[model samples]
Target: MASPLRRHAKLWIPLAFIAAAAVAVWFVAVPAESDGDPDYRDPTLPVAERVADLLDRMTIEEKAGQMTQVAVDAVQGDAVAERGIGSLLNGGSDALHDTPEDWAAMIDGRQEQALDTRLGIPLIYGLDAVHGNASLPGATIFPHNIGLGAAGDPDLTERAAQITAAETRVAGVHWTFSPCLCVVRDSRWGRTYESFGEDPELVSQMATAVTGYQGEDLSADTSVLATAKHYVGDGGTAYGTSETEDYLLDQGVAELSEAELRRLHLAPFEAAVDAGVGSVMVSYSSNDLGDGPIKAHADSYLITDVLKGELGFDGIVLSDWQGVDQISLDYAESVRTAINAGIDMVMVPFEYERFIDTLLDEVEAGHIGTDRIDDAVDRILTKKFELGLFEDPYADTGNADLVGSPEHRAVAREAAAASQVLLQNDGDLLPLTGEESLYIAGSGADALGRQLGGWSGAWQGTVEGVGEGTTVLEGIQEAAPGADVEFSEDASAPVVDRDVGIVVVAEDPYAEGVGDAGAGDHDMRLSGVDAAAVDTVCGAMDCAVIVLSGRPIEIGADRLDAIDALVAAWLPGSEGTGVADPLFGVTPYTGTLPVTWPARVSDEPVNVGDPDYDPLFAYGSGIQT
Candidate 1:
């Protein structure tokens, strides 16, 4: 219809415009090799290859920085990006006011700075989140490991860890120092509740938490690194041998033969390794295997030859808080020995700058080899790569809503209910029909902090109660709304002739070496205030005593004979309703005693298999109602 040249020009012009737009979209969408991106930045490559590429380009200063972990309060502005801090942690009480979103914002800001560094490598953040994302106030707080050990349900342990991982990731945290696999041999070690039980088999069974935290893949959005903590023999530390002042057993020595160590203590860690745990934290306590006691941080034979070589744990080996300093008074020697002992990361919580400079100097001198530094950096970076930090380092702000959700609390309630161990129920006193006139007495009746014990909101949980939690009294009232419910803190009120009196006694919250009992007035006996309340309530009416404590406390033989019912409510945490569920027949009493209930304060180290194993209640004893 038209001239040949004009018609052909018209078709070619439209086609050329279309081709130009398509080319522009392709360049913007796809990351071509010619875009000058490094192999480490490529998401398509294997994580090992990416780690290798990244490690090859890092400087010695950067490598040392990769092995240094600083506490959150110690970090100054721009220090994270400038010094290339490999990790950051929220040590208890450091940043206690941070909400879930606040934590996410802070972590994301730090991650942004880390990404702005020369290599643009992202940093990882960690927390003590031993029981749920407990550092955050509103996050779900599950029962302590002792309760879980009593529950004896691996599936429940796994579910608790899974929820912990999700909430932690939502807050932009990458790692949790959790699933304390210490098979506690001594109940007076202060961290007794952190252990699963006295038996290696029970502790090993709880190792399913590893699978829960990491999930099937590390790169998943909900996954966070899980640590099998205080590696080898923390719980077996001998009483009165502690280096920490006033601590009777914590940070003491585990004096035992190598065979006994393996048989009693090493089995849980071995199981953790088999579960593919991404990290192992060395204990602050020392181990005596036919030789003088040596700090685990300086024990090359155990960490390197045993944990790495024999156990085949390729994950990063981390030092506990100021753990290396305990090895030697000489800082340089301490650094040298700890590094030589195979500690991949140093938790130089406060003195990060000193640690970084000292580490670099050690590498410059012949004290610590560059190859070892490289190895440490490699292990650290491998985890960062596996965490998918390079591709998506920012927190999923949308997931912040998952913290303390109703669904999570439901699971925690279930775990708490399952963990209730009914020690005595004379004349079928328990499974109360929710129709009794209940008279609740004692400090633990309405105190959430006492029920949570240590590591609830702060390192050593507060007496004023740290986070949101329903108290046992409130749960009792909720369970029986139509019944007459009265609460008295000290039972100083006039005696009421109720159908039943519920007396709640508690051990005040303590963490680490501070909670140690068995030395001078710190014995495991019930506190005077709680005992007085117990006497007043049990004397006036038919009573059921609920002992809310971290470990077994001495309730004298007279008290045991007097009470109609006794329940071991070991740190039920935020979900106090679970404690009521079993009592009101909502759930059955399935939990057994994780540790033996001692007959007296003299039975300090009593356990399942002692030659003189006389206990008030044997290990695994629970009265089914």
Candidate 2:
């Protein structure tokens, strides 16, 4: 194979499109305030000026409120208006209302509460629309980041982000906590699927998501705030060091020299900052660069000195869910340490009121200074102003119909097709003609939740009514309209001489620490049932095995020898037809391996640059049809 990066360069968005999509809204215009409204409320004033004016007029309680973010479910009636809460987020829970209209209505009601405040500052709503409007059932679910990394097309990534932004904005969501830029070093990390690849360059290249989400003008109707998350080094943590219960590496420690930390984990964040991302979310992980392991939330050197001072990131430094609480046993110290470390806003979630009162006490007691509070509020208000929330606080229901529209699904289908990496194509077995009598087996063949993996309509991806989309079976049937397509859930039926056999072996849907392989009995291999299905089908006839998983699963040498062909179909989200496209020659296989596929489960940490690197399929190895 030729250089994967150079081959992918041809598919990048045209230079004209890049310019048109540039984040020019990062710099707002400065003009004289209009006569009618206050200077802070006037749309004509510069964002910095408006932020300063608002900061001056805000009471201490209001400023504290601006620095606090709580979950939507925790708030009671009129709590937002009464307490002057700054922002609300849906933290991996079901939507308050199912339809886009209802979602928008709910958020608009909350917006009215914020607008009724003394200063009339609008509230910014956020959600984990990491892959599409994931909280919404009827939104188009694009392939996860690992799949996009295999697809290796930044232009496609940008387009997907654009669609996600448009769909999320229709439901009155002003912000999305997405574009996870972690350079995954250990495959055992549960959030491996959330990263682009194990390489810094690839993760940096995918930062085009920020541009796609923000667009040229953040004030544009389609735009939503993009957060570059798990700041610093969440991906480079050592195994078994996780402080989180029942996890091997989710929130573990990155014990490395400062040079190694900068080289391995800092590049993607630098690229995100250069992309003019709206905010940066601090990681729950800790890092030990010579001194000792210090939580990123409490590490002033990493947060303030490095991310803000060195990278020149003026955007809000937001904390993860209860991220500050992990810094110390004492809640007040945890709050004080995180705030003083330059975290602009805290995701207090349930304990928001306590957070507000505690923050007020800290400021009153001189534990935290007024200047820091003002600075945090300044960043928070600047983003709110940039999002044009002051001018238009309500949701625009014009694009509500586009939430799960066929047009967006078409794009997702194309992405799913492009992301299929053909690793083993012995005897040239793939690109099956439509005329072949096909027998499809295994659970992933018809399972939508299996294809979507995690972070779908819920925190963990689910199979039931995760909106509407094609499954592998449906896609195959559609691709071969006239061909006889038969299916068996486990290949339990006696096999006849079918022209071809395709078995889709899938990992169970999971997210975060629970997905970590080393934490439990998860050996990173195919389940016994899936393995038996593969053997039963391949033993009787020619077969192609599609491993549907978040990361590479150990297939073993015997399983590889049995199958005529193997494809890594890393969690293709809602568009299973994309998986069928390349198999049927509708789209050629161009995706390369994003991570090294280990020959055995024992080769756990194998990577491209390692001295003893030996893999069943090396990184960047993918067969072109």
Per residue, candidate 1 scores C-alpha lDDT tens digits across 1-625 of 8889887986898899999999988656442333478889888998889888888777777888899899987999899988999999889533355687788888888889889887888889998888888788877888999999999999999999999999888888999998899989888778999998999999999999999999998878789999998988998998764354645487789999999999988899999999999999999999999989889999999999999999999999999999999998889889999999999999999999989988888878899988888889899999998998888898886877788889999999999888899999988999898888888888788998888888878888888777677888888776667668888888887777788888999888888867888444446778888899889888888889998988998899888788999999999989888899898988899999988888876677888888977889999999876
TM-score for each prediction? 0.93, 0.93
lDDT of 1 at 70: 92
Model 2 lDDT per residue over 486-569, tens place: 899799877897988999998878888778887664558898989999999998889999988889888979878999999999
lDDT of 2: 0.88
Give me the overall lDDT of model 1: 0.87
Clashes of each: 0, 0
lDDT (0-100) at residue 230 of candidate 2?
87
Clashes, model 1? 0
User: Which 10-residue window in model 1 sums to the lowest lDDT?
Assistant: 26-35
